[model samples]
Target: MLDANLKTQLQGYLTRLQQPIELVAALDDGAKSAEVRELLDEIVALSDKITLREDPTGSARKPSFVVQRVGQPMGIRFAGIPLGHEFTSLVLALLQAGGHPPKVDADVIEQIKALPGKYAFEVFISLSCHNCPDVVQALNLMAVLNPNVSTTMIDGALFQNEVEDRQIMGVPAVYLNGELFGQGRMTIEEIIAKLDTGAAARDAEKISAKEAFDVLVVGGGPAGSAAAIYAARKGIRTGVLAERFGGQVMDTLGIENFISVKATEGPKLAMALEEHVKEYGVDIMNLQRASALVPVDGGIEVKLENGAVVKSKTVVLATGARWRNMNVPGEAEFRTKGVAYCPHCDGPLFRGKRVAVIGGGNSGVEAAIDLAGIVAHVTLLEFDSQLRADAVLQKKLRSLPNVDIIVSAQTTEVTGTDKVNGLKYKDRVSGEEKRIELEGIFVQIGLVPNTDWLKGTVNLSPRGEIEVDAKGQTSLPGVFAAGDCTTVPYKQIIIAMGEGSKASLSAFDHLIRTSAA
Candidate 1:
């Protein structure tokens, strides 16, 4: 159950309940069921407005519980223990079900309430996944806001049979109305856009109507946030357009290298960044992807994918980088079937299964070390003869009994039928081909800059990174680039922020000089 400190915190949070709520549990006599019962009892003990009831005939999933308003139908359900990353989701579900107002925008709440058809969303997640809570919490909030929507957060680890039967090889696998909806990290806006097909067109129209910005930031990662904040602080019109705020940082787990802070999670840090940016007069736009950048008569006009255009006096390109794909055969076809990129997000789905790590860098070695604890075995393939990871990490990886390492190995193909069953590789030393049977493959090779859209518009390096001067100025005047998308050496979050600030300053200086002339 909950510790004394945790119980005290839960009790404090329970004070926010404005109305009565019920926890109707559908549990068996197993150990997990007993644990669930104890948890429910402890929860009810804290709040007078909360009640617990056993509903053995409620859900087919044992050790499950439903959170709903008193005398109302169940809206949010948990099919497994809601601990670890999902603990926040559980708390939010309680507060939302108890008539506490959610922090979501008023328009979004209204949109949820207006949705036409009934939606039964079931999301499979692992407690260790950093990305699962966002999906779970979003759906839970939707369920609480709209009667037509109901959601169940199923822990894939606890329900092995269901996971196997559904062929779910990744965490945060979502299903709507008994069919596969999507697999991977998704935001509430993204989810809504998917459900409400007209949202994109409406959003595009609204974006097209916005006035020009003094400094417009593309991409909402650490770099974009810093750039927007710096621009806004200068008493200028600032705006940020992002496909999704937080960029790769949202997919990240543990972040210890950020200075001043001892350690923090990615989602937590991302939230802080967003909140900090919102304190200023900067206009924030989310779920907007830039299709092309065109240098207009006075400023640059960035076209959206939905045929809308946004003009800005100066633009800071901080679109950031994405996980590098192997580009081998069967890799694309089997994605989410057995191939995955984020180890922290998707590792739990492959528990007790053999998997391969496709690099020898720090990320690869670290992934192998982490997966060795949960997975049956790990085969690490390195293109280089010697591992490039830190010596400490290499030592730790070698100590793992279930891990194997291959040097000068080139991944030939990802082999499988319906899902990934193995992989083929070539040994440089022996000039021989080999194959290893594995249930999953984790690609930790590196990152590719998200500069494809700006390829013809901006000067790009051989590796497809935007080439920037010392002032973070790109070849195009009044246009700058920062963060992982640029030729900056280190792609650390702190470096990205600093680079973004520098880019903003440079863009501002350019504006002054041009206006003076």
Candidate 2:
């Protein structure tokens, strides 16, 4: 039910409307003032063109509009945020509010859906957080598909108290019966499994750690896989947790520099490495993420968002960094075709073609140098006043026969019809604009630390890199951070792998000391 202030506002509108007015995300929140009403009216007129799902029961209301009618009481309900994973939840809430009982699949899903029957569920999420939205939408869908379900969302930013009271911890935390219990990204299937837990009991089953491992590695990148291999070899029961079977290394199209392998694709090398580590009896938890880390015994306990926590003696955080995006218009539309982050992955596809490299730093110049040898021509554009690379590298780049360096120039647009055929540039000084024809664009604008989740928990450099000792030991005992994400520089596959192995050894030594004590 809406509070008094909100109820009065809704009632005033109910009196003026002829038919039921459709409610939408923008309108229900009072963001639509009189000035925006006309614009909204136009959008509503085109609503039929928009596709919508139907619920046999009205409890799951469609988002076309929220209605206030004559002689109607001003009772209101909130539909939680629909953006990110919560978007699916918004649909579910509308279904329940309109009067339909959504049939749940997994016993776990139903268990979560059938909260304590008192508090509402509010989940906040962002699209940037990749896996955060799934958990919320699963709950919302279950809530809407069921009659007794009446969940709603509060503005996460505005309703800080609501979040705290519910112990809303992170970007994607769920309020169950209006209480904060556990937070992490959960899939519909996983939630359903949780809801359907224990057909014998009609509720979710709670279990303790399977408790058979020491070090659990997260990510199958060079660091993670290497940690698993080393830990297992040292006679420590170990497991590897990776979102993808192979991390970014597998996505890397080419690697001419890994020792002994001469030239190979990142995926090929990762596959071979995967086989090598398996021989050592390392258990791989592929296609998964670490959802919770509970401290226990000699190390911390590891819990996956899939609702399974394993007991371990130590944890190695090796989650690698993701590619940076330009965030400009159409950059996403033509990513692999015209705009590329991994030059080695798609560089061969652009053989004898014209390409542009954005960034004036080491990566930018290195990519320019690499592509120059294969492409017809390479244009290196730098936004900085001057290239800040080392003199030796700068001289080497200048000497490249096919390279052209454009400094103090800003790229305004990556212009093309379907694929990247040209790029638009602006002169910071002369204010002149020029468009150059190119088939490819590689961006190396620097790297952002993917260690935001570990601040006070781990020692980090001023630049946010995880601080590792010579042996990859973090300040906190038993908590090891590795890979390009950490302080180790020269972000190459081999270096990250070596660091991972070292960290695993460090963790093993720490465990051994504790066990002997």
Candidate 3:
């Protein structure tokens, strides 16, 4: 249900529509369709400028709806129930169809208009992806502004077959004109460049896998870049492949713990990292994702998803990890607004405000203690009956005057309007649901390694992390693992960089010893 103030505000915005918009819902007789219909009915009833046309001719395969103005298709379509974070997508579509233009840069709009050919942008996204909305909204805006373009927003969860067909493991996996474009967060300018050049399209000379290297580094994160620089300095034929340089660090809002650098944003740091790596003689393969790694004669072979392969005498796995999400309601909706993952990156933003930290692990306790010094209050919520953090960390957390710890508390939902205002949690013992008012929620629930591709090629821990020795040596002789993807005790950027350096040096040592043999 819409709040009185919010509904009134929306009505004011809707009343100013330049034209009448029609919502043609292609729905079958199902619960999903019924739910969507009810939502649409409420929206259409808000203003006479909008109308709803229900069509029971929807394919049973997938439920969808279309928006049109003056009988002209705006190329805006929704394949699933636009709930949570996706609710914004629905509102933007309606507004665009009502003759309201998107708030994109004028220069970017001109660039989109000047695009050579018609581009069908199929942006596959997950509701929980914090970065997907921006991409989706940008592409949808391009479609609205240019009749030569069309856009479709596909919910990956609902369309599992398409996700499998495309082999999309990350969110915001975009495809342009039936070819895999790219994934993750990208600016409008970057998207335009990719669109103009058909960035993924390669020539035989570019993607023909005839090249071999002494050392190959997969991933372009802090660890991978460090490895490439170190290996290149050894005067070896080193190469690095990445879907996008910067990796998880690119998503970080602010980085203050990277040594020497007092404060910096993720994109700035990513650019600096790429520039530094480029200073070396390393062969860089940008926008490439390794799909498989196998042993070859006297070396290892790496196969990319784009049908490119490269053989290397030694390999360094620097693929980083992603933060584990809460996967609860309102969590995704307030992402980047009030729900954050990296405490060091986003904790300062909540200064002098009450915040909650989820999980009872070391990460969560550490975040709560760190935040206690800055924020007005810190509430630590743990799902387990007992805290799993180290004794020292638990002691420090308990000593904090502004920190309150709660055990056996399950976070059910993140509640807010525009921004996070509160959270809902259930007590495991008492079986009572309670609401806590807080401005922000930090999710410190461990990490998931990006080493799923190297599952059989290397030995993995029961926790799914790649097992590595102190020398950064993996189960395989020629293959080394580093960074958060490996069994590194610490998951800091500096530690990952150091591990990457060790792996590269180890690879070089292997090379020298093998040649001597």
Candidate 4:
């Protein structure tokens, strides 16, 4: 049943429809069918532009719903009730059916249209997975725009047998033309890049810089974008080089900690970041990786992996960081098999099954708490004497009956022949070994900075973080650092952005002094 507030919100959303939408619910003698019918009824009552009809041909195994405009089929179907985070997917599909094109660029649309063959996408999803909506929306838009493409959204819980048959261990597990496409949340460009052969290399052109810039930002994450904006504001030539924009933020699920905004997802925030940076006169170089940095007489020569070279008077390193692995036996062997890093993407695959979470930091603890509701049992292991999560999160975890926390424990192995079946751990103080039988494992220890390319070119901490000062200045002059790649105490979106602005301003200060001298 829809709550009063939710009903009001749905009504408001549907009132903005540009065209009438028709929902066809296929039902059978099943509990889910009746539930879906009732929900559609409620939704249909919200606005005059929406209507619903029922079909009794659906089987008990998979009752489906098809969304269309007036009498035109949109080729968008849902094999199960689109509840939880998937509600957003249904809303977007309806909007697309109402004649609204996707928010993608025209060039991207043309690229997708240029594909030669027909493609079918089957996207597996969990209701609670925040990342699934983006994947589903991107594919749905593709299906809507192209005549040769079709898309379906499958609820992982309702169709457990199919999920197990496919060995699907993650939400947003996309299947293209009956074969595994990819998993997790990805941009529209990324999806098309995989389908279009030679697309990756062809779509990305070599970045060429003819003249030097006063400031060159090394990454396009929050910090680098902020730095680029600030540097460009100084009325000087500024450029940004990114292997891929958005960095670690692209991996985030829901972001509530970022100040000002009440709530936003990783991909959405990343889009906004790119758009905000584009607002300035900064030279944004995408899909370009900095392989080496050489300090020149008055500036640094940045060498890209594509062999392109660019000169800059100053540089800001915001290369960002990646997830740290357990490094234990079978951990790497079972990656995406039964081991996963993203809790939102793979948590549902382990529903009603046992799983273990490695590390007891904020990320690990949060993963345990989030997974506890989806998985049958959660065993959290920490190498330290106590949990490092916030007190509030720790309290919430304690209240969950299906969660177990072990401190001063060391993970020895992720045991499995084909898929993860169990984990071996050691009690550091008691010198006792223990084994916990589980179907999946989630590791969230920490992040390793992406500063391998900057090795020896600039001073780095023993931990591989770029060494920076109070003003975001690195060990070398005319160089600065920000975000997770730097020696900053805390790594947060707001903090990185603040540091980025500081570093850009510092670069401008250096240029001003140099010009005067």
Best by TM-score: 1
Candidate 3 per-residue lDDT, tens place, 1-517, comes to 5667766777877876788999878877778767778778878889898988866574343567777785787777777777655677778878887888767658678878888778888887766555677687778777877788877888776777876565454567788889878766776656886776654445223765557899999989989999999999888898988777888877765578989999986766887888899889778777677889989889998888767777899999988988888899999888755787766545545657899999999878988987898789999999999899999999999998999899999999999877889999999999999999998899998889988888888999987899998899998989998998998887888888899999999999999999899
Off by over 4 Å in 1: none
- Clashes by residue pair, model 3: none
Error of 4 at 229 (Å): 2.4
Which 10 consecutive positions of candidate 1 have the poorest summed lDDT? 342-351
Residue-by-residue lDDT tens digits, candidate 2, 303-338: 665566666778888887776666776677766447
TM-score, structure 1 vs. true: 0.99
Deviating ranges (above 4 Å) for candidate 2: 1-209, 253-256, 291-298, 305-307, 333-337, 344-354, 360-377, 385-403, 412-440, 446-449
Off by over 4 Å in 4: 4-21, 46-61, 70-72, 203-206, 209-214, 253-268, 281-288, 294-312, 395-400, 430-432, 515-517
- The local distance difference test score of model 3 is 0.81
Model 3 CA deviation exceeding 4 Å by range: 1-114, 117-184, 187-198, 203-205, 327-357, 360-380, 384-405, 412-426, 431-442
**Sorted on TM-score, highest at the top, how do the candidates line up?**
1, 4, 3, 2
Candidate 1: tens digits of C-alpha lDDT, residues 113-203: 8899999999999999998999999999999888999999999999999999999999899999999998888988889989999998899
Clashes (candidate 2): 43
Overall local distance difference test of candidate 1: 0.93
lDDT of every model, 2 decimals: 0.93, 0.63, 0.81, 0.86
Worst 10 residues of 4 by lDDT: 200-209
